[model samples]
Target: MENTESRNTAFEDIGQRISKAAKASRRSVSDIELVAISKTRTADEIRPLLDRGHRVFGENRVQEAAGKWPELRQDYADVELHLVGQLQSNKAADAVELFDAIHSIDRLSLVKALAKAMDKLDRRIPCFVQVNIGEESQKGGCAIEDTASLISQAQAAGIKVAGLMCVPPSNVSPAPYFALLAKLAKGNGLKGLSMGMSGDFESAIMLGATHIRVGTALFGERSSAG
Candidate 1:
């Protein structure tokens, strides 16, 4: 676990980096949202960031978030949680109940499930249709060619399609992938681009990533025990 002082310093450093990237791109710093990826981190591990006034976070699993956030939100009521991993259709209701935003809407089944869940709960949850930007067989995102249709389908189902999200192929320059996502969002008449990570977020910001999901840079590498 990271000590409070180191965590605070890291948090501030990330904020400064984001500001610099946003300015370099001629974009507003306020427009880029930094979603601290908190999956696999315990509540105690996350509390220090909250103490530092950081609120937005991303979790990979609905069940993991359910285990912690309800209790944590009791104290930090304004905390915004985003689901940033592959979501199964069966968990749509639980996700609709918890996450402030969903960034992995990739398939029609998931979209329909989310739409049904939102209607049942009477809560409109914003979603980012994940695009398999690198065309990786192992990753979870809608195929690049299917992105437009997915966004349209999500909107027609009453799901608030916020934008698009993607994880570029690892060990390569991510700038092109980020640019492609931005272009795709613009083509679909969307604004949010949820791309970037701890390692490449600066490039992502320069290429117009509206939201960056950072984990190891904020929380440090996860222990083997996790």
Candidate 2:
């Protein structure tokens, strides 16, 4: 009970901070969805947040999420799970079945696979096209030049292109990257911008992020899922 109260307190503290940030940005607090990232955290660590009424959560891998969330969701039916990690082409069907939103749709092949999965399973999960905003060779998003075409192709294949997502270059100011992602989303008629993590979520909200994926700030440091 004490632990649950602590969790509730922490969740409310973050919510208040997010609300204040949204107001400062001239956006309604209700408009922003706080996705408490539960990547390496166990369901035991996550349930307190769920008990405190945090319905949205993000995970980095399909297998890890699969290990826990099914049982958690069985208890809390209102949970909205998001995939915040890179998705493989072969995992599209499982991803479609598990996640409510996907924030890492980055390539043409994934676009096609997700489309087919959604069609075959009769479930359409919203997807955010991850743009390689920093253009890092080792990252997981599509190149900025290819973003528009990929989104178009995804749309053509009947996948719901929700918006754009990006992880800015580390150790650099993320404002420009967030602003650029917002610009691209607006230009392409997309609305959701899935950016920002623990450190820069306030900046992202200021720059028009409808979905902020926060992990460490809310959950503290995770040891290891294993």
Candidate 3:
């Protein structure tokens, strides 16, 4: 089928890119994970990618993920679900139950809610802080000014402080921002950095990203699952 072919082509393209980047950077291809972001795509599209051996996925909206995860889990129980969106406090319980990683914790209130949710469910979860390295007011991230303090709060609440995640501002060089995050993560000795996306992933890899939230490049334009 055409969809299957597209998935194959996309996988090959991503593999080629990863190989080239890893070679260029002199880092092992196995070091970095290419999370095939399946935000708006359906099972028809995602199944092919999973069949191709992509076990990690990123979803941008909690609502969308809530609808798709059940079906996706039925087929791929081993799939790792990552919530890469601005998580609302009301959705903390659902997120803790559904996602393997929360890559957008940028507020103290959000962290408190997540901690409570995890405690209530008696499950320890992995999570990351979203830093606004680009300083874009439109984007949802902890302003760089308050990062260390935020981390302390999460730590006190018994939340697993995994790493940091960030979105580079559009229409500009994101390298400096990525570098800043890299330095910050190192300073904190964090274990993960879910930076970069379809457009700026190579740069992200170069700056020591452990995970990339690739959506469009992996699944084509957003599929209206509604």
Candidate 4:
């Protein structure tokens, strides 16, 4: 049972949050789109979110997306799926097929493999180049220094490199990192700046973020793995 009343309440609450944040940031509510990272989330949770008309969905792992997307798509074919986690070369084919847009085209191997997979399928999916702007060793992305070269290489290989993505350091302001990614995108002639998250998305928007991969704030804490 959807329980339309509960769905409406959740939608209104999240919309109000979006409204207040957008006003405070001096941006229009439509300027930012929230991707509900539903990785590791069961359909019982997702169906309600979708029922509320929240169509943007994000997943972290390829296999999890592979498993979940089929059922989700069967039910909610209109929801847009985004891959917001590290992608592996071995799983590139499935990723290429599953995601409408991949926000984590980070490594050279993954990019190359994605190109190959799309080529084999005779398709070209939109992709964002992940930049480890904060340079965290645990983070998976091409460094800011390597982003331009990677984007050029991907474009040459027939992959459409649309923009830059990054994760800012925790406990520090994310504005600089978001701004840097925006500058990098403009300097390199890229269009999308995929930065920020549940915590720092406002900072990201202030710095010209076109895409914010929000998770916890939208769907609560996700499971350890998706």
Using TM-score as the measure, name the better of candidate 1 and candidate 2.
Answer: 1
- Candidate 4: pairs in clash: none
Provide the TM-score for each candidate, comma-separated.
0.98, 0.96, 0.95, 0.90
- Pairing residues by index, what is the TM-score of model 4? 0.90
lDDT score, candidate 2: 0.92
Candidate 2, residue 142: Cα displacement in angstroms equals 0.4
Question: Which parts of model 2 are misplaced by more than 4 Å?
Answer: 1-5, 224-226
Candidate 3: deviation at residue 200, Å? 1.2
The sequence of per-residue lDDT tens digits that candidate 4 reaches over residues 80-115 is: 899989888898998888888998888778878998
Q: How far is candidate 1 from the true structure (C-alpha RMSD, Å)?
A: 1.0
**Root-mean-square deviation of Cα positions for candidate 2 versus the true structure, in angstroms:** 1.3
User: Per-residue alpha-carbon lDDT of model 2 for 145-202, expressed as tens digits?
Assistant: 9999999999999988989999999999999999999999998999999998899999
Q: Can you tell me which runs of candidate 4 are displaced by over 4 Å?
A: 1-11, 24-26, 222-226
Clashing pairs in 1: none
**Candidate 3 segments exceeding 4 Å error:** 223-226
Ranking by lDDT: 1, 2, 3, 4
> What is candidate 4's local distance difference test score?
0.82
Winner on TM-score (1 vs 3): 1
Q: What is the Cα-based lDDT of residue 29 in candidate 1?
A: 97
Q: Pairing residues by index, what is the TM-score of model 2? A: 0.96
- Model 1 scores a C-alpha lDDT of 0.95
